[model samples]
Target: MPVVLSLNIASKTIPVDYTRTGVTGIDKRPVDGPLEVRPPGKKGSSGSGVAGDTIGDLTAHGGDYQAVYGYAREDLDYWQGELGLDLRNGQFGENLTTQGIDHTHARIGEQWRVGTATLEVSAARIPCRTFAEFLGQRGWVKRFTQVARPGAYFRVLEAGRFAPGDEITVLRRPDHDVTVELFFRALTTEAELLPRLLEAGDSVPPQVIELVHKRSVIELDS
Candidate 1:
């Protein structure tokens, strides 16, 4: 009934001067560390809570590698087929590759143990234009965000350190079924999805909240 192998992190986005670009970038660094989640108040380059969009999470925030799940070698092929993706590239910046646990299926209020810290799958990653440039597509960024399934946004329940090959055990999953993929769609463009997702703000992280709010306002004014 459960399938989660491990979560890992890295000291930097890449080896000294190692730039991550294209689908092959996932193979650049294969290391993991204790999971860490960022809250609204967490420091950002602007001294405010900044949430990186899905693709940006791996590159924009300048984060090395954070939370990730493990799965079979072919799991990626499965997702590419399931999502109709190219499968040759990865948009998430996580240094840790995934295996069994379906990141797309992760939902709000779900709790899991990552290394020594506990995390709740609260929201989905929101892709930004910066990611489009990284992905080498002019429209891929917006297209990816619309497709959602942008991986899970984990809210850190506790702070700690982790490394590659560390096992992540899911403690419990709340009684919600809406997935991170659906959530991204609803919030970014569903227009009506923001209110419903915000209604459960306690379970949603500020980063996700801010993105939804920003999109709604942008659309409203447009």
Candidate 2:
């Protein structure tokens, strides 16, 4: 059973060179909590869904569709071996550091009931200069993209509170093969896979839908 291994929130923003905002909330620290969560409106206007968490980049980071970020502990372990760094929970800027969840393979729109809250897998986290700078890794973005282990971002469907060690129950899963890994690949590296994203229907991110439509138009014109 999947469980929240660590519940994290940024106590404050850290000044950074990579973002337009000149700061980042990527330095999240684990908290002992019954953290409150809810839909955080839209990008540029809203902040993190998790109460007390901060989103320094208002234009790009937090929104209804990306209210909470979840990264699997297994993946962190994999990176620890690859990078020889002491990667800990919340090290990847995830609101929830989860155990026993295959976040990379999780289907978009899959619903999970954690504590009293329900969250739907909405999209995959896109690597950016901020993350690369945070990790102090050269070619971090490209390497992350190549691995396609981009963790899952979720939207709060039912508002409630959750804490570390709370069990995550799969309430439902959309009947689609467009897993988070595939979605990231389609958007980043494999333009050819864009058509497959349609299988996820409305669960697909609006930006990705736009890309798919553009690809169709370009193909037709050619």
Candidate 3:
């Protein structure tokens, strides 16, 4: 059964030895007991989906479409062996470290009822400079993109509390061929796949849909 292996949150942005942007809430820590979860709201500057959590750069971080981030523990375990290190839960800055779910294969707009909250898969985490800095790996962006196991972000539908060990019940999956890994590839290395993103319909973020359409037109013109 799919379940949340760990719940993580950062109360404030903190300084880091690496990265110029100070690394922000990338250093999330696991918490015990139940914690409130909700939409980051319409404001770009909202804290994370978890109550009391904070995001440093609102311009790139918090938003309604990216209210929560989730990564599968199995995927992290694979990276642990590849990196030859013991990676802890929340190390990837995921709000929920899940088990038994395949992040890469997760369907866009898939709904999961966790505890009392309902969340729908919205997008995949895009590797950024800060994320590379957090990992302290050279050519991290390229490497991660090639590996292409970017975790999924979720939009909160029903606000409620959840805890580590809570079961995640799949409520529904949208009738789309777009998976998280596919979406990430389309956004990054594979422009040819951009047209396929349209199959996702409204499940794809509106801004992203617009961008893809623009790219499609440019490709046709070129």
Candidate 4:
């Protein structure tokens, strides 16, 4: 049984570029009270975590497919040793810092009953230049990719509120065998695994599906 160790929300501050040492919403702070979670749209386009969390780049960060970001406390512990920094909750830009959930082992499309809402795993958070700059780590993107512990992003299925200490239970799991790690690898370093993504069916992210189609066409043409 996984539990929400902390819930974080970003302030409504002006967006700043994360790369080149600029500020970004990646710095989320813990919220002590319950916050509404819902699908991304005009009213709540930021996605499912806290009501007014700000994302610097809406184009790549917030949306329906990435409504919620969850990271395991265990993984953070491992990174703390490697980075030698006191990494705290929300430091990874995750809305929920979770415990007892094997994020890497979680399959895409797996549904979890978290707090009063139901969320479905949709995609894995890909590292970017912004993340690297935020952490002030040289080659942070490549280093994080090698670790293959990208946290999970989820879509809000049933809108509700969630707070710290909320229990997360697996409500359902898709039959397909596309685990988060496999999907991340295929998307980042393992093009050879692209074709196998077909097994993920509709649960796979549309962007990845498009990439797979393009790869298949190129392979066929060659």
Best by lDDT: 2
Report the C-alpha lDDT of model 2 over 1-222, residue by residue, as the tens digit: 889999999989998777898999999999999999999996779999999999998888888889999999999999999999999899999999999989999999899998899999989999999999999999999999999899999999999999999999999988788899988988798879889988988777676688899989999999
In model 3, residue pairs whose N, Cα or C atoms come closer than 3 Å (at least 3 residues apart or on different chains), thus clashing, are none
Q: Which residue runs does candidate 3 get wrong by more than 4 Å?
A: 16-23
Clashes of each: 21, 0, 0, 0
Model 4: per-residue lDDT, tens digit, 1-222? Answer: 689999987875444565432456787889885888888852224543458787766666777778889999999999999999999998898999999998887998899999899998888889998778777899999999999999998888899989999999999988878888988899899989888877877667677789999988998999
Between 1 and 4, whose lDDT is larger? 4
Candidate whose TM-score is highest? 2
Worst 10 residues of 4 by lDDT: 41-50
Which lDDT values do the candidates have, in the order given? Answer: 0.50, 0.92, 0.86, 0.84
Query: Between 2 and 3, whose lDDT is larger?
Result: 2
For 1-222, candidate 1 gives per-residue lDDT tens digits of 332333333332332222334222232233333334444333233210112212223333422112332233345565466557664323334433455567777767677665565666666656655445444566766666655556765655665544445566788876656566667777676766665666554677566578777877898899
RMSD of each: 6.6, 1.1, 1.7, 2.4
lDDT of 3 by residue, 81-153 (tens): 9999899999999999999988788798889998899998989999988888888888989988999999999
The Cα error of candidate 4 at residue 88, in Å, is 0.2
